[model samples]
Target: MYQPDVFAFPEEGQSGPSLLPPPGVLSLWRVDVARHCGQAARVAPGILDAGELDRAAHLVVDADRECYVASHVALRILLGARLGVAPGAVPLTREPCPSCGGPHGRPATGGGVHFSLSHTRGVALLAFADVPVGVDVELLPKTGVVSEIAGQLHPAESRELAELPEELRPAAFGRVWTRKEAYLKGEGIGLADGLAAEHVGTGPRPGPGPAGWTITDVRVPTGYAAAVAVRAAGQPAARDGDRRR
Candidate 1:
C-alpha cells in the first residue's frame, strides 16, 4: 500500500515514491529548497539563471510564498523525469490563459501531458496524467478564515458547509474548495469559469460528461486537506494544465 505516513525526504541524488498516486503509476517527489529559483532550477533546469534563482529566492523564500514556489519546483522535476526532456525544455514560463487571460497557467512540453501543482506549508504536491488535471492543498491553520470567503463557494458547497458543525467547518470547507479548484484547473477554466462543489457522497466523483472530471482525495497528514482532479474526456494522453507560478 502507498503510505503517506511513511514518507521520508529524498537524500541528495535519490528520489522518493509518489504519495499522490498508486505506486509506479506516477512519479511524485518533494524537496526543500532555500529559494524559489533554485527549487525551480532543481526541478526544471535552465528555467532560471543562477542570478535569477538567487533573486527569486530572496523575493519568495519567506513563509507566505514558499509553498507556491515549491509546488512549481516539484512539477518541474516530475515532468522532466517522465518525459525524458531537459527540465528547462519543458516550458516553465507563466502565460495568461488563452481562453480567459486569467492568471491560471501551466508548463507544457507540447508533448501531451496535463499536470497540476499545489503547495501548503513547506511541502509541494504535483499531479501528472495523460489527461487534463489539477491538484490543490490547504494548510489547515491558514484556512480558518474560509467562512468569510464561504460565499465564494458554489451553492451546493455552501449548503454542505452549513450542515457541518462549527468545529469541523474548516476541514469541510477546505475539502470542497480544493475539490472545486482542482476540477476547474483540470478543465483549464481557472476561477473565471467559476468552481462549484457537488458532493456525491464522501468519495471521488467521476465526471458527468465526456469532458467532465474525476476527483480523488489525496491521503496526507492531519493538518492538511488535498485533492486531485483529472479530466475524464478522451484517451488519457500527456497534457499540461494550470500550475501556480
Candidate 2:
C-alpha cells in the first residue's frame, strides 16, 4: 500500500517533517496536539490562514481552541516543508466530491501533491503522497459508542465486531472506524456515502479496501487508533530518506 514510515513531528528549529520526504515518497507524521496546545501561544500566530484563525477563535474552550491551532499549525509547517513554500502560503483547498461532483471533498494542495489530515483532542495525523491519500486518528471510544455505531458498518464487519468481547470492542471499533474513514477520505466521498457501503474489518488489521485503494491501521500512542488510505494504482517510489519514529 506504500504506507511510509511514521514520524514524530519535528520540534521547532529541528530538522523537519521526517527530514522532509523526498519526491514521490508517501509520508505519515504524528504529533501530540494536546502537547502542542501548551505551546500554541508561540507556535501558532502567523502560520495559519485567516479562515483557520477564525475557526480556532470560535472554539471557546481553551483545550479545544489550542488543539485546533496546534494541529493546523503543524499541518501548515509540514505541508510548507513538503511543497517548498512558506507555511502560511501552502495553497490548501478541498477537491470536488467523487460521489456528487460537489466542491466539498478531501483537503488538497495546489502543488502536485495529495495529502490528508486527521486530528482528535490529543493527537493529530498527517499523510502526504504522490497519489490520492487519506488518513485518520481517533481516540478509543466508549463501549456505548461502539454499541451504537458498530451496527452502522458493513454486515460482515458488524458481525465481526459483535463477536468480540465487550471489553475489546472499543479498540476493534476504533480500527474499523478509522479504516472506514480513511478509505472514504481517499475516495473524496466522506461518510455521506454510507458506512455500510464498504467492509473494512473490525479485526486488528483492516480488510481489503475498495478497488484501486489501499487501507491499513497505523501505530499511534496508547488509547488512540489511526489509519491511512492511498490509491494503489500509482504508488510512489521508495526513497532512502524514509524514516521511522
TM-scores for every candidate against the unseen true structure: 0.68, 0.87
- Give one digit per residue, the lDDT tens place, for model 2 in 17-103: 546667666788776765556554475666777898888889888777766777787778777877777787889888777566688
Q: In terms of TM-score, which candidate is strongest?
A: 2
State the lDDT of candidate 1 residue by residue for 6-98, as single tens digits. 223233312333434432243333334333434444443344335435654676546644554455545554565565554444555443564
Model 2 misplaced regions, further than 4 Å: 1-18, 234-245
Measured with C-alpha atoms, the lDDT of residue 117 in candidate 1 is 70
- Report, for every candidate in turn, its global Cα lDDT versus the true structure: 0.54, 0.76
Model 1 weakest lDDT span, ten residues long: 1-10
Candidate 1, residue 121: CA error in Å? Answer: 2.0
